[model samples]
Structure formats: structure tokens, C-alpha cells
Target: MTVRMFMGDARVDAIAPDDRGLAYGESLFETMRIHRGDIPWWDAHMARLTHGTQRLAMPLPDATRMYAEAMALLDGADGVLKLQLTRGGGVRGYAANSDAAPFWMLSMHPLPNRIDSLDTIWCEITLASQPRLAGLKHGNRLEQILAANEVRAANADEGLMCDGAGRVIAATSANFFALIDGHWQTPVLDACGVAGVMREWVLAQVDAHVTSLKPSDVECADAVFLCNAVRGILPVQRLGARAWPRTHPEIRALQAALAQSHPGFEPLLEAS
Candidate 1:
């Protein structure tokens, strides 16, 4: 995979070995989809990135230069773009010095093959409550990595994670939503989970509610689905012993709504 490294105003071929982000996961990243050479939600992604940098007290590289480099790297191809920003090189401790220059990287990868439906599993790796980093998409992703491993073991497409108290949080790499009693409901990310970009769009496009949901609530819902910026929206066909009918109206409506908003998801609606 080809990667372009950025440190302050200069670009390099590779990341420094002693970077803090590499040592302690002290970084933030955003995975975005490029369609016809344009990143539809670039502004939103950058807004979240800036928010994360501010919260972490980390410096941000030049946005204009970063955008230029990213676009140049895209080269008019439609694919996934990942931006990783680290706290640069640091002397071996948790005590942040605040003076270190930030190191950032931009890499482009092939998009995952499109699937009509996703089979999800309820993971056993419970999310610990951490309000300080609740909504930001930080690099401390061991929980998600573990949950995804469980998903692979279960032969499922993705894993649904819950808090230590058993309240549903999110999918391993996406946010979850379910239809219950004709209403769209999703778990609140107040105490855990990443607030996904596609999730924010869905909340605006549909009449969705954020509430604390139990595992049984998801299992007994009228229909269930997951959403992420990269893959758009996905319908869940099965979760554990429970299976949902493919033609659930709520699911179809959500897919249609997504298609109307983003042409990239139109293929998904057709496949569904």
C-alpha cells in the first residue's frame, strides 16, 4: 500500500519509528470514501478531526495542504482514504510535552466488496465507560480490534458491542440502528462508542431516537441495520439465533432514503 507521510509543512516517505502514535496509539484517524474524485463528507470528517485534535490538545497540520495532497493521491479514483494524525516523536512516557510537532499520514486503500446484507454477532468484549473519549474516533481501538476478532470467529460480518452494563453501544466498525415499534432507534454514544459520520446523517434524514438499548431490544426489534461512512447503510439479516425478513419496510425505507442522499449507496439499495 502506498502511503504519504506529512510532518508539519514537509512530506516524507515514511513515519518516524519513534512517533508517539506508533508507540502508544496516541492518534486519531478518519476513513473516508472518495467518489468520482470527491469526498462528499470531507467537511464533516475534518470537523470531527479538528474536534479530536482540540480535545486531545494535539496540533493539527495544514488543512489546505493536507486536502491538496489527499486529492492528488486520489487521482480521480473512487476508493477509501485513511488519514492518521499522531503526536509525533516523544521520549517514552505518558507525560505529554505539548511542544512536539504532529506527524500525519494519508493512505489510500481498495474499497471492500459490496454485500447485500450483513450477518452480525453480539460480541462478548464489553466496552468500558470512558466519557472523555466517548464520541471521538481515536486510535485507542483495542476493544474494536478484539470485538472484530470475535466477529471473525463467529463467521459474522460484523460485531455489535455493548457497554459493561449491557447497554448496546455500536458495531465493531460502524454504528447500529434498529426499528422498534415502527420507530428507528439507536444506542446513545454518551459513555462509549464512536459517533459515526454516516450515523449523524441518518439521524438527520430519518426520525431516529438515541436511547439506552438492551441486547434483547436489538434481538426483538422489527428490523435491524448498521451504518458507516465508508459502506453507507447495511441491513442485518441475522444476529445470533434471530433472523429478520429481507423485505422489512423500515429497512427498505432507510435504504431508499440513503440512496436519495448519496449515489454511492444506490448500489446497496439495488442489491437489497
Candidate 2:
């Protein structure tokens, strides 16, 4: 992976030992899909990052400079780009230094292998309801890390997470969606989960409802899928004993629509 580190506007070599992002997890990050050296959803990612900065009261890095540097690092190659913004170095306590320059970094990596379907398991780890940090991609991710480990141990491709109340929230790394009673419904993330860019686009494209769901609702749905910025849409084939043997026509249609809007996902459709 190729990476560039920055402190406010100036380039930097390494992260400071006392960086608040490292010490206290005061950071936000966005992972984007790059197609032919261009980030089609760059604006959307930045908008989410901006929202995170506002919530955390951290300074945002210059968008213009970030874009230029990201493109330069890509060098016309297709890959994944990650942008991370931290509160920078701080004093040895929980108190933040508002005047300190923010630390940020941009890194480029090879795209992950394409996946057409998912074999998911119900994760035992229940997401804590933190309304203030619910939708932001903040750096504190112990829950996801543990859930991902569970998925790996279970030999599942993904894991579905719920809140303490047993309300289905999302997948370990993607947003969850279900088609029930002829309507598409996704779990509301007002109190948890990352508000994924692809989820927003899909909601705008279809007459989908953002509401609460339960495990039984997902198991009994006509169809189920997972979505994120990198992987446009992926049908869920199995969740433990329940299996969706056939791909729903609506899922194919949405995949076609996503390919039309974002050429980066066209390859995923072909692979599917």
C-alpha cells in the first residue's frame, strides 16, 4: 500500500506517539472505491467525513489537497483509497487541545476480490447504542473487530449485528437490507451502525423504508442483501440454517442499476 501522512496542510513522515487518534480513538476515516484512478463517490465520502469532524469537533483537512494527493497516489490505477483524520497529538489526559493541528493520512491499496453472495451468521456481539457516534466511521471499532473474528471462526463471509435490544442493525462491514411484504426495508441507524454511502444511494433509487427489524424478520424476508461503497450489492445466500437458493429478480435489477450509475460495480455484476 502507498500512504501519505499530513498534519493540517503540511506533509509528515510518521504518526506522533501521543496522537489522540492512537491514544483515545479520536479519529474518523473513509474508505472509497477507485475505478480507473477516479473516486466516483468522493464527494459522498467527504460529506460523511465532514459530519464526523463536526460531531467530534476535529478540524477537517483541506478537501482540494486531499483529492490531489489521492489521485497522485493512485497514478491511474484501480484500487481502494482510505482517508483518516485524527485530532492530532494531545496532552496526556482526556482533555483535548483544540488548537492543535489535525493529523490526516491517505493510503492506496489493491481492491478486494469480488463477492457475489454472502454466507452470514448472527454475531453474538451486540452493538452498544451511542447516538452521538452512531453513524460516523470513527476509529473506535472493537465491536466490529470482535464480530469479524467471530465470522472468521464460523467460516462465514459476514456477520449480522444487532443492538442490545435485539434489533437487527447491520453486517460487520456492510449495511443490511431485506425485502418483506413487497417492500424493501433496511435497519434504521439513528442509534448505531455506519450510514453507508451505497445504502443512501439504494434508498434514493427505490421506495425503501428505513425502519427497525428483528432476526426473524430477516430470516422470513423474501430476499436479503448487503451493501457498502466498495461492494455495491451482495445477495445473502445463507444465514446459518436458512438459505436463499435463488437470486431475486429485484436484486439483479438493482445490481444493473448500480452498474449504470457507478461503472466500478459493473465488474462485480459480471463476476456475479
Using lDDT, give the best candidate's number: 2
* Local distance difference test, each candidate: 0.88, 0.92
Tell me the spans in candidate 1 whose CA falls farther than 4 Å from its real position: 269-272
Residue 34's lDDT in candidate 1: 85
What is the lDDT for 239 in model 2? 90
The global Cα lDDT (0 to 1) of model 1 is 0.88
For candidate 1, write residues 50-157 as lDDT tens digits. Answer: 999998888999899889888888877778999999999888889776587799999999888999788988999999999999999999999999999999998889
Query: Looking at model 1, how many pairs of residues clash?
Result: 0
RMSD of each: 1.4, 1.4
Clashing pairs in 2: none
Q: Mind giving the per-residue lDDT tens digits that candidate 2 earns over 179-224?
A: 9999999999989999999998999999998999999999999999
TM-score of candidate 2 versus the correct structure, residues matched by position: 0.97
